[model samples]
Structure formats: C-alpha cells, structure tokens
Target: MRIQRIQAIAISLPLIKPVKMSFEEVRNAENVLARIETDNGITGWGEAASAPTMTGETQGSMVAAIRHLADKLEGLPADDIPAAMHRAGQYLYGNNSAKAAIEMALFDALGQARGKPVYELLGGAKRMRVPALRLIGTGSTAGDIAETQKRLAEGYVAIKIKVGVDTPEADAERARAVAASVKDDKVLICTDANQGWTPDEAIRFVKGIADTRIEFFEQPVAAHDVAGMARVAAASRVKIGVDEGLHSLDDLRHHHQLKAALGASLKTIKLGGLQAVHDAALLCEELVMKVNLACKIAEAGIASAGLMHLAAAIPSVDWGVSLSSPYLADDIVAEPIALSGGYINVPTGPGLGIRVDETKVRRYTREV
Candidate 1:
C-alpha cells in the first residue's frame, strides 16, 4: 500500500486527576494525533503527548511538524517505514515526538496491510504480558503511603515514587513511608526526580533512602549534567536511571561511560519512535543496563498501544512498563488500554490492536 494523505489533529483530553511531577503538574493531556490514509483506503492512527518539559514539543508544534512532513512523506511506500522515517529525518532535526507519531501511523498501516501486529514488525514478542509500573505521587507522605498500599493491593508489581518536589529529606521520608506500605518484598520500588535536583541534593535524598528498599533513582539532576549525574550516582547506593537526559543511542553510551545512570526510562518522545527505542533497548541489553519502557505523563490509547507493542518486543522491561492511558478521563479508542489487576496484556491484534473512536477524537479535538 502507498501513503495517500496525512492529517494532524490536536486534542486536549481531560486527565482523571492532575499528575504532580518535579517539573510541572499535568492537568490535561494535550496531544497531537496523526491520521494516515493509504491508497488502499486503510486508515491508521498515531499519537504523541505535548511534553514541553521533556521533548520541547507542544501540541501546536507537533501539529505543525506533522503538517510539514505530511506532503514530504505522502508518496512514500507505506510498508517502507525505515525509508519514510529516514526521509523525514533528512528534512527535519529533533522533533522526536512528532516523528514518533508519524512513524507509529506508518507501522500501524503496514501492520494492517500485512496482517501482522506491530510487535512482529519490530521483532517478535519476548513476553505477552508485562508488569505495569504505577506512579505514587499524591503530594503528601500519608497520601503517598496510602496510594502505594492501594496500588499494591490492586496487584501492581512495580511502583515509582515521585520525589524532588520538596526538600530531598522530606521526599526521602515520603518515599520511605510509601515503600514501607508495600508488604510484598517481591514488589519493585523506584523513584524519579525528573531532573529536579542538584547533584548534592539528589545525593542527600539517596542517602536518606539508603536503608529503604527503593530499587533505583531516576534523573536526579538536570538532563545535560552528566557530571552532576555521575556525582549523584557515586554518592548513592541506589542505581540512577536517566530520563530527560536520554535522547539518542549516544546518550545511553555517554551515560554508561560516565556511570551516570545504571538504567533509563525509554520513551518514544525521547528516542523518536518504536524502532529507535527498540535499538536503544538492544544497546541497554548489551550494556547490562536496566530498561523502563514508558509513555509520557499523559498519552491517549494510541501512544499507549504503541508502548504495549514495544513492551512486548523489547529484550527486557527490567524497570517495568509505564502506561499513561489509564490516567486519562476519556480516551480516543473504543476500548482503552487499562491495567487489569495492575498488569497490562499486550495487544495481540493486527496493527495497534485498538479501534480509534473518531467521534471521541473529534470531541476532544482542539484548534492548534
């Protein structure tokens, strides 16, 4: 099948509740959706959340990027995803979030045409069902502890406590209380500072949590501060994982070299697309670094499904998979991807394995 048309739709979907992180509080999910039509009349969909703090792409920016690339990619063969993406890269630099949306649409269209799932196109499923990593940041120590207990009761195998919003000592106290709430010793516990701390502050936080069962700490300092990251990593017994700091395979290598982080939170918004994330995961495996596959703070079902496919095919989800569709009050899919007892089963159907609800999409659509 050949590409016929591509249109970018911008939407603002309501979140179930605001998610508090170190950088910003997310009240609503502002995202851009790419609708790609093949000559054979197959319609495929893709989405990306506008994460200015992470990818420097807003809803308007992603929409414009998709519009800029649409005509350039319109005549390319639908099945030749790599060629199409390479052409896009030649015409544009950065804009990984926008590229990810378009690349996801191409994969969906190709998978539909070939009657295969997106995971198969990547490689093959290493595992069918993946553990869902729950975020426990209710903005209070008691709230966090209660939330952690609730999530643990719901069967979440992994949990990430949000820190860096307050004093490192205060956040550490909250994390300890939260971690103590989880009675199951098998549960994975981690923390993400989201690049919100100084090296010394992060080191202090890790020191406070030294006796806690928190598995790893993520993005403790600024994204560009590899030296700061290295210092924090050295000061703490907890393994550091990079999030905002990682944008390419080279970033992974650099972090590995400096001992900045022992794991990374892989996101399409950071890496560009599924292929890029898959390649990064392969590299992580080779380096023996842990992997945390995730969507941005709030993405709809399309991006969430894309994550599921990646989660299915990636070599290891040692840090667990974080899906954001569950945070949305409404999703643009007929059946949204949700955690069943805190675990998400990968979509097994052709393409993205979810039906796009055009009506819902239109309802949520906003002028960009």
Candidate 2:
C-alpha cells in the first residue's frame, strides 16, 4: 500500500515517580510520536524520544522533518521501508528521531499487513519472556540501600545503580552500600557512571570495589573516549558496558576493534529504530559480545514495545533488558503492558500486539 499521510504529535506525560539518574532527574516524559497512514487505510504508530545533545534531534525538529518529507513519502509503498528511509535521509541532514519514528511506524504497518507481530517480521521469537532490571538512581548510601532493598522485595533480582554523580569516594561508597544491601551474590548488580568519570578515576573507583560483586560498569568515561575506555576496561575489575559511546553499527564495530567494552547497551532511539537495533544485535553476536536492550527514561510506548520484541528475538541479550516499565502515571495505551516477576511477556497480537488508545493519546498530545 502506498503512503497517504504522515502525522507527528508531541506529548508530555507525568511520571508516576520521578526517576533520578546520575546525569539528571526526570519528572515528566517528553516524547515525539509519529503515525503513518497508507492509502489503503492502514495506520501504524512509532515513538522517538530524543536527547538533542546525544541524538542531535529535538521533538520540534523531528515533527518538522517528518512534515517536510511527507511529499516524498506520500506515494511510496509501505513495504519499501529501507528505500523510503534512504529517500528521507537524502532530503534531511540528521534527525535520527524523525527517521526512527517514521521507520518504526512503517515496520508496524508491514507487520499488520502481514498478519504478524514485528518480531516475527524481524526473524522470530527466541525467548517467550525477557527478564528486566530496575535501575536505582543516585542517592545517599542509606537511601540507595533502602531503594535497592525495596526493589528486591518487589521481586526484582537484578538492579542497576546510578553512580558518577559525585566524587570517586562518594560514588564508591554508594556502590559499596548497594552491593552490600543484597544478601545473595546471585542477585546481579551493575553501575552506570553515565560517562561521568575519567579513565584513571574509573579504574580506581572500580578497583576499590573489587571485593564487591558488581556485574559490570557502564560508560565509565566520556562517550567519545575510546582509548580511555579501552584503558579502563583493561584495568578495571568489573566488566565494561559501553552505552553513550556506541550509538550505531559503526560505533559498535569501532568499540569491538578497540576492545573498549565487554557489553553494549543498545537504545532504539540511539541506534535509530528496530532495524538498526537488530543490525547492532547481529554485529554484537558476530563480535561475540553481549548486548542489553536498554531504554531512555521515558514512558512505555512504541519504543518499549519495539525493544520488548527485539529483546525476545535476540538470544545473546544475556544481560537482560532495561526497558522503561509501564509504571508511569500516563501511558498512551489503554491496558498497561504486563510485567510479572521482573519480566515482560511478549505481545502475541498482530503488529506491535499492544493496541494504542487513540483517545488517551490525544488527551496527552501537545500538538494536533
């Protein structure tokens, strides 16, 4: 079916509870939603929550780019996604969020037309349920320990604590407290510095907690510091996971060549879309490295659904998913996607399987 219309909506939904990480505190989620309508009356939805400094696209830019590309997309076949994307890219510079939003919607449309979930289209499901880890944000040692215990009591076996907010000593103390909170060593604990530390400091801080069981360290130094990351990875006791640094297939390959990281945190927005994420997963497998289907601190929408399907299909995602849970006060969908025992069940319906509640979405929409 040929594309008929492309629409973009910006929504700001309040979080049930503010999530504080190493870098910043997030209250409401600002997400740009894209919807594509085919001449055959098929509609598909996508989400692209941009971090302008990271992906170089803001919500306003994403909307404008999609609107400007509407003419080119109007007559294109929905199934010619790669070609359509290439055409769109030729016209624009770098609004990856805009590109991802359109691409995901097209994939959703293709899945619906084929009478299959998106995962079925991208290979097939390798696992029924994907385990998830609760990310504990930055706080004092006592507060951090309390939060860890609370999440553990809520049946979350794995926890990722935010560090690098303060000095190395303060961050180390927070990490140590979190590690000591859980009695079981099997309860996996990891720390994300959010590229807050220098290479030397990362090594020192990670080594200080050598006795504690930290599964891995994430983005120890700045995103572009490949050589520094390699040095830290070599010297640190904990395994290294590159997050902000590796955004694309080339970035992943570059990190692999430099031996900069042992694992990668693949964010859909960062990589652009589901296709990009799948490509990254295959590349990770080829390199014999682990990948984690991660999320930005946003409400559950198309992005969450896409990652859920992607994580279920990839067997190498051993580190579990760090997906944004549907625990937000306002989710765009009618029924909250279920999470049981710290794992989310893959949707089995056609397309994304999770239906979008148009009324709810409109209520939160900032623009028509």
Best model number under TM-score = 1
**Against the hidden reference, what TM-scores do the models get?**
0.99, 0.96
User: Which lDDT tens digits does candidate 2 get at residues 43-83?
Assistant: 99888775665576776887888888888788898988888
lDDT of all the models against the reference?
0.93, 0.82
For model 1, the superposed segments whose C-alpha errors exceed 4 Å read: none
| Displacement of the residue 169 alpha carbon in candidate 2, Å | 1.4
lDDT for residue 249 in candidate 1, whole number 0-100: 100
Query: For every model in order, what is the number of clashing pairs?
Result: 0, 0
Please give the lDDT score at residue 290 for candidate 2.
83
